[model samples]
Target: MTAKVTLSFTDETIEDARRYAERDGMSLSAWIDQAAREKALRELFNAHADVVRRAGHDRLEKHALDDAREVEMVRSEFRGRRAAQR
Candidate 1:
């Protein structure tokens, strides 16, 4: 299911996002949605890392780095597709 909602942002931010969306060959909504999803995933990963640290895992930092790499891989894949289209 999909729902539409209104959002407001500073003019500078709106312009920046529009430029990024255009550069990525995506709609503004899609660019914002991908950013929001990445933010949510990062938050969840941080919370999990904290829990692991509390559980006496000394590799929490490494796990966080791995998570970051995963996100970057996804972004690279999207960019690759856009490049291929050109």
Candidate 2:
């Protein structure tokens, strides 16, 4: 069972939402629902990341170094893309 809800937005926001809805081939309500779900998932991931960072890692020297190197490579690639755009 579902209950109906009313939402209000500024004209510009409504236009943007309509555009996004058309792009996704969904009704504005469906598009908003999908966007909300994605946002919730991202927030959950961010919360998990904080917990993982606090715990720290216990690992062998070689394995730890390899993991760090992989992370560095990804960071550098992301930075390079950002730098190119600027």
Candidate 3:
């Protein structure tokens, strides 16, 4: 469901926005809607950017630990092989 919104803008601004809307092959209302949606998304992302960063950091740390464990396991296997060949 969508509600109609009425906004007032300077004539010059409205003209510029109309031109942009035509250039993008969209209606003026659609252009404004997209702009507002994008602005809202940006604000939401900014608000949780730190939380996102921390989640990413935690994932990288887990991957690093898992990789280290795998490498050590391979090294141990090779050491055992060398011992058997001795």
RMSD of each: 4.5, 10.8, 20.6
Which pairs of residues collide in model 1? none
Better of 1 and 2 by TM-score: 1
Q: Model 2 over residues 52-82: C-alpha lDDT tens digits?
A: 5666743343464467775676567555543
lDDT by residue (15-77, candidate 3, tens digit) is 999999888777787678766765775676455555646677755654654677756865675
Candidate 2 lDDT score relative to the true structure: 0.66
**Per-residue C-alpha lDDT of model 1 across residues 1-86, encoded as one tens digit per residue:** 45699999999999999999999888888788767766886787689778878988866668666787777876786676455444
Candidate with best lDDT: 1
Estimate the TM-score for candidate 3: 0.55
- The count of backbone overlaps in candidate 3 is 0
- Compare candidates 1 and 3 on TM-score and give the better one: 1
Worst 10 residues of 1 by lDDT: 77-86
Error of 2 at 57 (Å): 3.5
What number of backbone clashes does candidate 2 have, counting pairs of residues 3 or more apart or in separate chains?
A: 0
Candidate 3, lDDT over the whole model? 0.68
Q: Count of backbone clashes for each model?
A: 0, 0, 0
31 in model 2: Cα distance from truth in Å? 0.1
C-alpha TM-scores of all predictions: 0.70, 0.61, 0.55
Displacement of the residue 85 alpha carbon in candidate 3, Å: 71
TM-score ranking of the models? 1, 2, 3
Clashing pairs in 3: none
